[model samples]
Each structure stands twice: as structure tokens, then as C-alpha cells.
Target chain A: MEKVTININGADYSAEVEPRLLLVHFIRENANLTGTHVGCDTTSCGACTILLDGKPVKSCTMFAVQANGKHLTTVEGLAQNGKLSPVQEGFHEKHGLQCGFCTPGMMLTSVAFLKKNPNPTEGEIRWAISGNLCRCTGYVNIVEAVKYAAEKMKESNQ
Target chain B: MIPAQFEYAAPVSIPDALALLRSNPDAKILSGGQSLIPLIKFRLAQPALLVDINNIGGLDYIRAQDGWLKIGALVREADLEDSALVRRSYPLLYDTTLSVADPLVRNRATLAGNLAHADPANDHPATMLAYRAEVVATGVNISRVIPIDDFFRGLFATSLAPDELLTEVRVPMPKPRSGGAYLKMERKVGDFATAGVAVQLNLDAAGKIEQIGIGLTNVGLQALRAKRSEDALRGALPDAKGIERAARLAQEDCDPASDLRGSVEYKRNLVRVLTMRAIEKAIERAKGM
Candidate 1:
């Protein structure tokens, strides 16, 4: 076992874990933050998405030891205190989900993507979330949710 | 799913990483962990130790130096996709970077890792084959530059020794009036190519082909350079007839297996069509039109 300290959503979690522990398992099982889902363990599905060191990555495809000293942000970190983040509010306002299994990953991907492109066309939004697969809603409302979040983010920054 | 038990070492220096590999020949060097981790999860690879090289510094770089573009082993695919310099100067490389798995995977997949994996379906091998790139392999107290032609030995195999780590990739600067492009046909986003073609060519002042390189991907045991196609085009202007013949040779050169992607005939014909289109696009870019 290797001792590792990882900062997730502004809190540091330390543990002694097996060297083969996947980062998604570390987040869900060890840290008790179950928002990050493990839909496809093969890295094909983006259900395990998270921000590692301010960049998005598939946590299921990385070893927990590989993230030993990195800063991570899971879906649970999207809101501040009790308020929903713009992306979260956009999802609620736009009815962007049905089963919600792919929601956390979708919101996290959108939050990070908006940081790079504040105003994205529908095509760009569709492309940005291409990794996150949603079996429900057929992705039409998800694109709307991203567009809604983009507007909200731009308005607040003004 | 959890990977099988293994020992992990985070090496902060190249020498330390090399030393770890030298001592544990059964160990695997984990750079980015985009491809290796998946294999580990599926139990396809069960190395006893994993040498995590992310802790090492001074490897993440993509810069032009001494008339060549040098890409360090640690540079992620996203870095190339976001680089304005790459977009402005090397459209061929930029195209390949965009076609890699997806935006999220590109954030962690390294160019060196992609090449070192040596999967025929991987994108960069054909791009490097077209560019005639060279890789720097560093072992304990020994480093050698190997041409891309001699890099891949077989499927999932490379010429790199167990103690060696691919540290850098160097692509020669393209000559003036030159352009290149890569075209791939995949089932969907992030899927491996059914058949892909990478073409890089330079034109003389008379608009005659001065030099050319063609690489075929996923239609062979390894990325194969279309030497017959290239030889037929040198010093000749690219008319429709010449381009058609070159494309036909590329179709004949490849040996693709019949699989779910396509039958051998379908793949060969796809190669011919993509080759013609890529050459035309490359020629258009070469004229700067």
C-alpha cells in the first residue's frame, strides 16, 4: 500500500491505499464523494469525469497513486456553500436530464468547457461534451443547458 | 474495476526512472496513463511495478528549435490542439491531434505514449511516418535517436529496450511550399480508423512535386510508408492521372485484415479514395490558396 494525499473540492483526503486503486474508486469509495460515477470502466464513457489540476480527465482511467499530490474537483464541488453553480442551475432550468446517471459528469465537463470557451455555438457545445454519453434526453436539452450556462456565466462576469 | 496488485514508484528524474526500469525489467513506465491504465484494468497487461514519470520535470514542452519541431514526451495532445503555433505552422500535426480519442482523453494522452504504444490503429505513428520524425530513447547513461522507420517492430511492440524511455520526438521542419494533411474514416468519434492516410509533400517553383511521403494507418501490421506512391510522384506535377496512379499504389501497398471495420477490398478502396482526397487537399495547402 502507498500513502497518498489528494485535495478534492478544497478538502485534503489522505489514505493508505493499494497501488492499483483507480482514482474514481478513491473518490467514490475512499473519500466518500459518490458524485463521480463509473459508467464505463474502459474509459469509453465520460461518466467518471473530474477536474484534476484544473484540467478534465477520466478518473477511472487513472490510478489513485497517479493523483497523489494533485488538486481535483468532483461534481460535488460545483456549487458554493448551498447555492447551485451556473451549470447546475442551467440544468435545472433547462430540464437537461432524465435518469441523472450522466448528470454529474456532464455538468463537470460543461463547467470546465465554459472556462475555455465562454460562448460556444451549438455544434461546439455538442463537440465539447462528446465524451460524456447520455442514454436519456437524446442530448438536445443538454446542449440547451450548456448554452444557458454560458449566458449566465457571461452575465455574471460583466 | 480494480487493477491487479502492483508496486508503484514515482520517479522525479529521468535517471531515477531509468534506474527503476533497469532494476525491474517487468515494470512499465506510466506516462499520462491514458492507454496503459485501460490495459491494466482489462488484465491485458499486469506489470509487477509501474514507474510513474509524471513527477519528473522538464519534459512537458512543444517548441521549435534549430529548424525542427521538438515535442517532449510529457506534452499532452491537448497542448498541441490548443497551440496557436501548431495551428499556424503544422496543419498536418494539428489535424492528427484533433482526431485523437476525444477532448477529455487528449488532456492526458501524450504524443510519446501514443507512439511508444506502437498500436497500428493509433494516429501519431502515421503522422510521424509522413513527417519522417525521429524519437530520442534514453536509458541509463545511454541515449540514441531512432528514425520513425525503424521504430515499430510489430503490433503492440517497439524497438525500445526495456530500460529505455522515449523522452522526445523531433520532426524536421517542412520546406517552403509544402503542406500535409491526415484523413481518417472511423465508425464514430474516438474510434480507431477503419483506414487512414497521411500525406506530406513539397512543390518546386514550377509546382512539380519536389518531395513526398505517404503513410497508411490500420491497414497493415504496422504503419506502412507508401514508398511506391511517393516514388511515382517525385519531380512530377500532380495532375489527376498522376494523383490517381499514386493513390492506386497506396491501395496496393497496404495489407489490411478483414474485420468488423471492413473487408480487405473495402479498406483498400477506402485507402485509394482517402489518398486522392488528402493529396488534393495537401496540394491546395501547398499552394497557400
Candidate 2:
């Protein structure tokens, strides 16, 4: 076992996890932050998306040990105390989900993506979230949700 | 799913990474973890340790120096997507890499990791073959260069020594007016290649085919340079008749394997179709250059 200290969602966390333990397992089990969902063991599905050093990545595909001492932002840490993030509000307003299984990963992944390429078009937005699959929304509404979030983010920045 | 128990260490420098690999020859080098982590979940690979090279600096760059395109081994596909050198000089590599998995996977996966894994279905091997790239590897106290074709041994196998790591990929610039492109068929956006073709076109002063090199993938145990196709293309017109004949020769050169992608015969047909498409695109690219 390797003892690792990771800063996830602005919190410094220390744990003694097996070397093979995935970042998703570490977040969900060790830190007890289960907002990040694990849908596919393979890297094919991106339901376990999170921000590693401010970039979106599949947490399940990364070893917990690999994330040692890195800044990670998950869906659970998106909002301020007693306030929902704009991305969270976008999903609710757009009816962007039905199963909600892929919601947390989808929202968090989009947060980092928009930050990198802000004011993206519909086509770019679709391509950005291509890794995070949504079976329920069929992606029509999810794409709109991202656009909505972009507008909100732009407003907040102004 | 959790991988089997193993020791993991991420070294901060080349010397530190080398020491870790030297101590654990049975361990695996974790790059993007896109491919390695999946294999671990399936229990297909059970390495005793994982030598993480993510933090090791000075291994992620692509520059043109001394008449060669020098690409550091740790350069990610995302880096390639944004590389001005690749876009300006080697659009074939850019095109081939853009078709890899998806944007998210490309952001994390390294170019060296893909080539080093030596997957038969990978799209980049054939491009490297046509470009005549060389793999530079560093061992304990020695560094050596291996030709692309010789570096890949078989399916999911490579000639890379356990203690050695790929350091650089150098693609020698072609003569003036030479161009290349990779064309492939996939069932879905991120699906493995059904059959792919990478073709290099070189024109003489008179705009005729001075030389040609064709490399094919998903047609055999590993990617094969289509020597027959290249031979047929040399000294021919860079026009309709020449491309048609070369496309036919490209089909004759292939020995495809049957799988979920297609039957051997279907792959042969695809080789003909894609070879024609790639040759045309390559000619256009080369002409512009």
C-alpha cells in the first residue's frame, strides 16, 4: 500500500490505498465523496469524469497513486455553501437528464472544458462532451445545458 | 473495478525513473493510463509495479532540428493536435491522430505510448512507417535508434527492452514536393480501424512520381509497408491512371485478417478504396508543399 496525499476539491486528503486503487474508488470510498459515478471499467465511457489539475479526465482510468499531490475538482465540490453552481442550474433548467446517473460527471467535465475554451459553439460543445456519454438525454439537451452554462459563466465573469 | 495489488511510484526526473525501472523490470510504465488501466481491470496484465513517468520533465516537446522532426516521447496527442510543426509540415500525422479515440482520450494519451504499445489496429504505426520515423530509446547507460518497422515486433508486442524507454521519435524530412496522408474506415468515431492506408507521394522536377511508399494496418499481424504498391507507383504519372493502378497494387499487397471489423476479403476491398482516397489526398498535400 502507498500512502498518498491528494488535494481534491480544495481539500487536502491523505489515505493509504492500494497502488492499484483507481482515483474514482479513492474519491468514492476513501474520501466518501460518491458524487463521481463509475459507469464503465474501461476508458470507453467517461461517466467517471473529474478535473485533474484543472483538466477533465476519467478518474477511473487513473490510479489513485498517480493523483498524489494533484489538485482535483469533482462534481460534489462544484457549488458554494448553500448555493448551486450555474452548471448544476443549467441541467435543472434544461431538463438535461432523465436517469441522472451520468449527471455529476457530465457537469464537472463541462466546467473545465468551458474554462479552457470559453464561448464555444454548439458543435464545439458537442465535441467537448463527446467523452462523457449520456444515454438518457441523448445529448440534445445536454449540449444545450452546456450552452446555458456558458452564458451564465460569461455573465458571472462580466 | 480495482486492479491487482502492485507497487506504484512516480519519479520526478529521468534518473529517478530509470532507477525505478531498473529495480523493477517486471513493472509497466504508466503513460496516459487509458490503455494500461483498462488492461489491468480486465486482469490481462499483472505487472508487479507501475513506474509512473508523468512527472518526469523534459520529455514533452516537438521541434524541427537538424533536418529532422524531433518529437519527445512524452508528447501527448493533444499536444500533437496543437503542434504548429505537425500542422505545417506533417498533416498526415495530424489527420491520423485526430481520428484516434476521442478528444478526451487524445488529451491524456501520449504519442509514444501508442507507438510503443504496438497495437495492430493503431493508426499511427502506418503513418510512421510511410514517414520513415525512428524511435530513440535510452537504457541504463546507452541510447539506440530503431527504425519504425523494426521496432514493432508483433501484435501488442515491441522490440523495446524492459529497462529501456522510448525517448524521441525522429521523422526525417522528405525531399521537396513530397507529401503523405492516412485514410481509414471505422464503424464509429472512436472504433479501431477496419483497414487503414498511409501513403507517401514524392514528385520529381517534372511532377511525376519519383518515389512512393505505402504502409497498411489492420491487414495482418502488424502494419506492413506496401512495397508492391510503392514499386508500381514509382516513375508513374501523379494523375488518374497512376493512382488507379497503384490502388489496385495496394490491394494485391495486403494479407488481411478476419475479425469483427471485416472478413479478409472485405478488408482487401477497403484497402483498395482507402488507398485511392489516401493517395489522392497525399498528392494534393504534396503538391501544395
Candidate 3:
């Protein structure tokens, strides 16, 4: 077992975890932040997406030990001061989800993408979240949610 | 799914990592874990030890020197996709990097790791081959540069020894008036190529083909260079007839197996089509079109 300390949601948490423990499991079990879902443990599904040092990555594809001393942001970190983040609010406003199984990953992926590309077209938005799959909702509302979040974030920054 | 039990070590220096690999012959070097972790979870690979080199500094850079672009082993694919230098100097590599998996996977996947993994269907192998790149490998007390042509031996196999780690990839800068393109056919985004082709070519002052390299992906046990196709195009006009003939030669060189992506014949057909298209685009780019 290796001891590792990781900053998740801006808080430090340390644990003695097996070398084989995945970052997704560490976030769900050790940190006790279960908002990040694991749809496909394989890298195919981005259901376990999280921001590692402000860049999004699939948490299931990384070992817990590898994330030692790194900053990570999960779905639980999207909101602050008891209010939803713009991405979360966008999803709520635009009805971005139906079954909601892929919502956390989708929102996180969009949040990071919008930071990089603030004004994405419909095609660009579709390409940005292509890694995160949604079996339901047909992605129409999800695309709108990303656009809404982009506009909201832009308005606030102005 | 969790991976099997293993001992992990994060080495901060190259020598320390090499020493660990020398001691643990069954150890696997973890660069990004975008590919290795999935294999471990599926029980396809069960290494007794994992040497994590992420903490090692100075191994995640994109530098240009001595007429070559050197990309450190730890440089992430997303970094290459976003690199203005790559886009300006090696547009083919830049475009190819964008087609590798999705944004999330690219965020963590490394170029050297992708080549070292030696997945026949992966994108970088062919792109490297077309660019005439070299892999820098370091071991216990030795460091060597292996040409990309000789690096891939077979499926999931490389010339790299168990104790050696691929440290960087060096690609020679394209000559003036040279152009290249990478074309891939996949079922959807983030999918491996059903058939992929990378072509780099240069035209002479007289507008005849001077130098050309063709690399084929996902159509054999390893990424292969179409030497016959390249030979046919060199010193000849890149007209539609000559290109069609070269494309047929490239198609004949491939040995594809039927799978979910397509049948052997269908993949061969794709090789023909993509090769022709790649050659045309490369020629146009060479002529500054």
C-alpha cells in the first residue's frame, strides 16, 4: 500500500490505498465524494471525467497514487456557496438530461471545454463533448446547455 | 474494474526510473495510463510492478533544435494538439493528434506512450513513420535512438527491451516545399481507425515528385510503410492515373483481418481510397495549393 494525499474540491485528503486503486474509486470511496459516476470503466465512456489540475481527464484511467499532490475537481466541486455553477444552472435551465446517467461527466466536460472555447458553435459544442456519451436525450438539449453556460459565463465575466 | 495487485514506484529522476526497471524486469512503465490502465482492468496485462514517471521534471516539453522537433515522452497528446509550433511546422502531426481519441483522453495520453504501446490501430505510429521520426530510448547504462521504421515489430510489441524506457521522439523538420496529410476512416469520434493513411511528399522545381513517404495504419500486424507505392510516385508526375496505380499497390501491400470495423476487403478498399486522397492533398500542399 502507498500513502497519497490529493486535493479534491479544493480540500486535501490523505489515505493509504493499494497501488491498484483507481482515481475514480479513490474519489468515490476514500474522499467520499461520489458525484463522479463510472459508466464504462474502460476509457471509452467519459462518465468518470474530472479536472486534474484544471484539465479534464478520465478518472477511471488513472491510479490513485499517480494523483498524489495534484489538484482535482469533480462534479461535487462545480458549485460554490450553496449555489449551482453556471454549467449546472445551464443544464437545469435547458433540460440537458433525461435519464441523467451521463450528466455529471457531460457537465464537467462542457465546463472545461467552455473555458478553453468560450464561444462554440453547435458543431463545435457537439465535438467538444463527443467523448461523453448520452444514450438518452439525443444531445439536443445538452448542446444548448453548453451554449447557455458559455453565454452565462461570458456575461458574468463582462 | 480494479487492476490486480502491484507495487508502485514514482521515480523523480531518469536514472532512478532506469534502475527500478533494471531491478524489476516484469515492471511496466506508466506514462499516462490512458492505455495501460484499461488493459490492466481487463486483465490483459498484469505487471508485478509499475514505475510511474509522471513526477520526473524536464520530460514534458516540445522543443525544436538541429532541424528536428523533439517531443519529450511525458508530453500529453492534448499539448501537441494545442501547440502553435506543431501547427505551424508540422501540420500533419497537429491534425493527426486531433483525431486521437477525444479531448478527455488526449488530456492524459502521451505521444511516446502511444508509440511504445504499439497498437497497430493507433494513429501516432503511422504519423511518426511518415515524418521519419526517431524514438529515444534509455536503459540501465545505455541510451540509443531507434528509427520509427524499426521500432514496431508486431502487435503490441516494440523493439524496446524490458529494461528500456522510451524517453522522447525526434522528428526531422520537413524540407521547404514539402507537404503532408493524414487521413483516417473511423466509425465515429474517439474510435480507432478502420483504415488510416499518412503521406508526406515534396515536389521538385519542375513539379515532379522528388521525395515521398507513405504510412498505413490498422491494416496489418503493425503500421507499415508503403515502399512500393512511394517508389512508384517518386520521380513521376502525381497525376490521377499514376496516383491510382500507386494506391492499388498500397492496397495490395496491406494484410487486414476482418473485424467489427470492416471486412478484409473493405479495409483494403479504404486503404486504396484514403491513400489516393492523401496523396492528392499532400501534392496540393506541396505545390502551395
Instruction: Write candidate 1's Cα lDDT for B51-106 as tens digits.
Output: 99988999999999988899999999999999998898888899899999988999
Candidate 2 CAPRI grade: medium
What candidate 3 gets wrong by more than 4 Å, as runs, is none
lDDT of prediction 1:
0.93
Highest DockQ scorer = 3
What is the Cα-based lDDT of residue B52 in candidate 3? 94
lDDT tens digits by residue: candidate 3, A1-158 = 89999999889999999999999999999999988998988898888999999898999999999999999999999999999999999999999999888999999999889989999999999988999999999999999999899999999999
Q: Using DockQ as the measure, what is the rank order of every candidate, best first?
A: 3, 1, 2
DockQ score for model 2, please? 0.70
For residue B245, give model 2's deviation from the true position in Å: 2.0
- lDDT, model 3, position A38: 88
TM-score for candidate 3 (chain B): 0.98
For model 2 chain B, give the 10-residue run with minimal summed lDDT.
B236-245
- When 1 and 2 are scored with lDDT, the better candidate is 1
DockQ, each predicted model: 0.84, 0.70, 0.90
Candidates in order: C-alpha RMSD to true structure:
0.8, 1.9, 1.0
lDDT by residue (tens digit), candidate 2, A82-145: 6888889899899889999999888987888788888899998887777787877789988888
